[model samples]
Target: MRKFNLVFYFSGGGQFACEIEAEDMATAGSIAESLELRLSGCKGYDLYVKKEDK
Candidate 1:
């Protein structure tokens, strides 16, 4: 399984970012949903995951 970094941004004012190490996109989605917070945008990257493994 592969890991991913999920970044979530909120609409209130500042940024609400979380680095979630998940096996796949589905797991990341579930985790994001559990937050129950209002987010303006979301982005995922594999770069951090690769670097972390190094």
Candidate 2:
């Protein structure tokens, strides 16, 4: 398993970020997608996932 940093770039001018644990970066991205859909509401946003540095 690995740690990932999830960043959501919202269109409205603010940002949301969090850390999650997943087997790989892809899994982390999937998790981010779910979060984006549910959390972003009607606002547009871009999701980005990066592996956490040791």
Clashes of each: 0, 0
lDDT of 2 by residue, 1-54 (tens): 777766676666677777788887678778877777887433543444554568
Per-candidate TM equals: 0.47, 0.68
lDDT, model 2, position 33: 75
TM-score of 2: 0.68
Q: Which parts of model 1 have CA positions greater than 4 angstroms off? A: 37-54
Candidate 2 residues lying further than 4 Å off, grouped into runs, are 41-54
Any idea what lDDT model 1 has?
A: 0.53
Q: Cα deviation in Å at residue 32, candidate 1? A: 0.6
Q: Please report, as a residue range, the 10-residue window in candidate 1 with the lowest summed lDDT.
A: 42-51
Error of 2 at 41 (Å): 4.3
Instruction: Tell me the whole-model lDDT of each prediction, alpha carbons only.
Output: 0.53, 0.67
The TM-score leader among the candidates is 2
Winner by lDDT: 2
